[model samples]
Target: MADILTLETPRLRLRTWCDEDLAVLAAISADPEVMRHFPAPLDRDEAAAMLRRIRDHFAAHGFGLWALERKDEGQLIGFTGLGWTGFDAHFTPAVEIGWRLARDQWGQGFAREAALAALAAGFERLGFAEIASFTALSNRRSQRVMQAIGMHRDPADDFDHPKLAEGHPLRRHLLYRLRLDEWRERCP
Candidate 1:
């Protein structure tokens, strides 16, 4: 499939993966500070495999986590987009809005900006009734981004990630959702 470059925000452009992005993405994935909320930092090979998976997702669904670029500098920073959450939880078979950025870009509102663009694409262009996002309970930074983009969290819906072992610290996650109605109200 030809690369699809679909969404753009004021400061960022969300586009498809490219060969040039591999090195930077690998670096970002391998950074401990960037991967602190996840299982572990990805090695180069693991990052390459993840890039392949991301490409496949876009081919299969026409939209996955799009590679993020700083429009001003034309540099890859990270990714923010919609994806199918694939795992079973209190909420299974759901579409999710997610983002990950380079450490230096964290304080600049890039994640929230890219996420709002993704949410608009999912709700306005794609006609999705709802989209959900979840993160390790301790990832307050991500939680803040989700809330900034209008997703609501109810503690009652939090779940232990099925893929993690019982005692794993990252197993406990909080779920957040935004319905089309709510999104429309917020955006309109």
Candidate 2:
């Protein structure tokens, strides 16, 4: 319907979210392991709001978190792409590349495959000089993805997330960055 909205990797496809994705989104958001890094698990309304926000981002920015789908089964898996981390003293106008896969899809490399496509879009199409990703200190899996993508932690730039309250477990985060120049040098 929306040009199939596809971003391709060797084994995965990043596509636009369809109406069918809501259930998967809700399930993922409701998962304790998935929600562990978030301030709290989203209720239906909050989850719906997240969908609207990501959809609006694509409408406004031409690219956002493209819904990740399995090329083999065409099932909606999760999301991986770029988003505005919102402005702050420590982070401003940042393009954050992230991925979240369903529990069923974990340990299969889908997150990495889809995220690599998003990285290509960020640097090549969106003209981002650097793509940044952040996660709570406890989210070692996500941190691994950052490193696998050639990102490195910048401790001096780390800050408490502005959106989270003072005592939120996810407030204190580590920032990892991958510059376009660095990607070019490393991948070239």
Candidate 3:
């Protein structure tokens, strides 16, 4: 699987992660405000492990995450991409699209722009029939983004994250799905 060197959107660039991304990733993981819906803020070791897995995913799949940078400034504000996610029972064997940006970047439409680029890669380039997006039940901002990107909610597809303990605020999550047919329907 050869690495994907670049994926572009109007105001964003989705490219392979590099060593320089370590500090940017660490900043997001350590920010409680940024990680509010996650089970817990990641420590440096956990952050390091995640980046390792992300790189390994790229090596194995050829197309994994593309760390997002501002098109104009080349700043690593955060990342958005489609990745394989199997932990959720309802959406097993799913190629899930997701995004996380610096808190400062919220409400500016970066997540949606970056995510649409990822969705295009998954549905058009990778041949996935459908891609799913999910977030903790209370994470309304994410839910709205899913809707804005033309995804539809299926509460019946909700699942408690396997990594989260019972009764955890982040345990129950909602799913949003968009099929290739649906994407075509929207544009055609």
* TM of each candidate vs. truth: 0.96, 0.93, 0.95
Best candidate (score: TM-score) = 1
In order of TM-score, best first, we have 1, 3, 2
Candidate closer to the true structure by TM-score (higher is better), 2 or 3: 3
The model with the greater lDDT, 1 or 3, is 1
Superior by lDDT: candidate 1 or candidate 2: 1
CA RMSD of all predictions: 1.8, 2.5, 1.4
Ranking under lDDT, best-scoring first?
Answer: 1, 3, 2
The digit string of per-residue lDDT tens for model 1 on 16-126 reads: 999889999999999999999999999999989989988889988888899999999999999999889878777878999988899998899999999999988888877
Give me the overall lDDT of model 3: 0.86
Which regions of candidate 2 are displaced past 4 Å? 1-4
Which has the greatest lDDT?
Answer: 1
lDDT of 3 by residue, 63-147 (tens): 8777899979989998888789957485688889988888998999999998888888777778889998889999999999999
Positional deviation of residue 36's Cα in model 3 after best superposition, in angstroms? 0.2
Q: What is the Cα-based TM-score of model 3?
A: 0.95
Q: Is candidate 1 or candidate 3 better by TM-score?
A: 1
